[model samples]
Target: MNTEAEVREEMGYSESNSHRLFSVEEYYTSYGKIPKLCKFLGNNIIILWLIVKANKDMHQLVYQKMDCPELLQEAVELLKETSGVGEDVSATIHDSKIKLNEICRVIKEVYEVVAKGICMLGKLCMHERFLSLKV
Candidate 1:
């Protein structure tokens, strides 16, 4: 468990704004709204990704390195519409199970993209460190 000060430091917040850190009692009081908050965030991919990044216990959004298939599909469809990923996804039927393969394929694709992005960020950080040492 992270102390409030550690969390604030990781987020790059100044000590003067420490009031933003919520107490455990406050979290317990607001716990009942979590379900509604999740429902609201369901369609928001950027926010969902931020939650996945910020949460230490991320099993609620991702378990065993996989997002929920239905949620993943929804995110893919939203991206297709907004980012022009091109055309509606056709269902791939197998063993009389419709769209199962499509869901699996999308999940794999998302995992690859996320892995590559993390790798790129790691390389970028190392490059920056190397350059700083040369100064």
Candidate 2:
């Protein structure tokens, strides 16, 4: 787990403003309200795309670890139910599962994809593009 300082540094927030950020509990509380959040982002394609990419990256990480199948499954289910598409989401979940079943998968692939996704999100946030979206 990253230390608070490490997390702050990675997010490029100074120590003085770190205290204004959400705590773990607050973060989880926000996560728990994702259905509403999804509704809120209904008109924001860019932010929605970022979320989908992040979810895909997370699925890759979970697949590489093979240690949190339940969590991954739940995430896929949530994505399917909230994405406003039944058949396509099912197909996507199936494809992701098939990839996860590959015999010689490399962990580095997951790391690279996740890192790239995070970098993209960071850039978007840095430019205030994410904040400018209608929600």
Using lDDT, give the best candidate's number: 1
Off by over 4 Å in 1: 1-40, 43-101
Cα-based lDDT for every prediction: 0.48, 0.46
Question: How does each model score on TM-score?
Answer: 0.31, 0.22
lDDT of 2 by residue, 17-129 (tens): 44444354423213444454334434434455667779878865321222256446645544544443344335546655645434223333443445555544444454454
Q: What TM-score would you give candidate 1 relative to the actual structure?
A: 0.31
lDDT score, residue 115, model 2? 51
Clashing residue pairs in candidate 2 are none
The C-alpha stretches of model 2 lying farther than 4 A from their native spots are 1-3, 22-84, 94-135
